[model samples]
Target: MPRITYIEHDGTEHTVEVGNGLSVMEGARDNDIPGIEADCGGACACATCHVYVDPSWIGKIPAKDDAEADMLDFAAAPTSGASRLACQIRVGDHLDGLIVRMPETQG
Candidate 1:
């Protein structure tokens, strides 16, 4: 299992253990993490699952694809090098301790 660290806007943190093959968005939604809206249900059609990849973990994650890259353009918090859609990150043994900070808003 992979444990993900979710940090809310006010600095509240929740760690959830997720199994392999489940996406980060799924992990958040299943555990009821406050900030992950996941409105499009991991479809990549909505940026509701938007998150900021903690800089320290940036290099460890894979690069985004074209579709995910385009969806991020509409994210409310402004896209930067760390911006990513949670639906794209899958839980894996190597992803243990993955840390992601939620945005102030989804839309």
Candidate 2:
């Protein structure tokens, strides 16, 4: 299992345990976390599950492919680095303490 921490725009944080092999968006949604909308249900088509992965963990996370990269453009208040669509990040046993910062808006 992997434990993930989600930081909201207000600086509040929520941490939840997630199963390995599941997507970050699914982890948040399963835990009932408020920020991750996951409107497209892990399809790369929507950016509603956008999250800012901690800089220190950027190297630990996998790089996005062309499809996910294209979808990132739709995320509101986009960031060039550290921003990723949670649906594209799969939870793994090694990511026991992953942390993600949520942005204020998402389409």
Candidate 3:
């Protein structure tokens, strides 16, 4: 399992051990971490699971695909270089201690 940390806009943080191969969005929802709406149920059809990848971990995660990039246009908050859909990030050993910052809102 990989340990992931999700930080809210107000500075609240939730840390949990996520099972390998599970999406980050699923990890958050399963652990009751607030902020990740995942309205599309990890299908990558919505931006509700948007998050900002920690700078240090930016190079670790895979680049966003065209579909995810398109969905980000609908995010409630402004998207930046760090913006990523949690549902697109799969948990793995290399992602241990990964930290993602949640925006103020998710459309």
Candidate 4:
């Protein structure tokens, strides 16, 4: 399992161990971490699970696909170079200490 840390807009942090093959959104939702609405349930159809990968981790994960990029346009908060949809990030050994910050709102 990989350990992931989720930080909220107010600086609240929730760290949890996520099983391999699971999406970051599932890890957050399963652990009851706030700010990751995951309204589309990891289907990549919505931006409710949007997050900002830690600057140091920006290159650790794969680039977002076209569908994810398009859906991000609907995110309530502005997207940045580090912005990513949690559902698109699969957990793996390399992401053991992955850290993502939640926006002020997910809409």
- List per-prediction Cα lDDT, in the order shown: 0.92, 0.90, 0.93, 0.93
Worst ten-residue run, lDDT, model 1?
A: 73-82
Q: List clash counts for every candidate, in order.
A: 0, 0, 0, 0
Model 2, which residues run further than 4 Å from truth? none
What is the C-alpha lDDT profile of model 4 across 1-107, one tens digit per residue?
89999999999999899999999999999999999999889999989999999999998899988999999998887567888999999999999999999999998
* Local accuracy of candidate 1 as per-residue lDDT tens digits, 1-107: 88999999899999989889999999999998999899899999999999999999989999999999999999987567899999999889989999999999988
Q: Compared with the true structure, what per-residue lDDT tens digits does model 3 show for residues 1-107?
A: 89999999999999899999999999999999999999889999889999999999999999989998898898877557799999999999999999999999886
The prediction achieving the highest lDDT against the true structure is 4
TM-score of 3: 0.96
Taking the tens digit of each residue's C-alpha lDDT, what string does model 2 give over 1-107?
A: 78999998888889999998999999989989888898889988899999999988989998889998899988988788799999999999878899999999776
Model 1 lDDT on a 0 to 1 scale: 0.92
For residue 65, give model 4's deviation from the true position in Å: 0.5
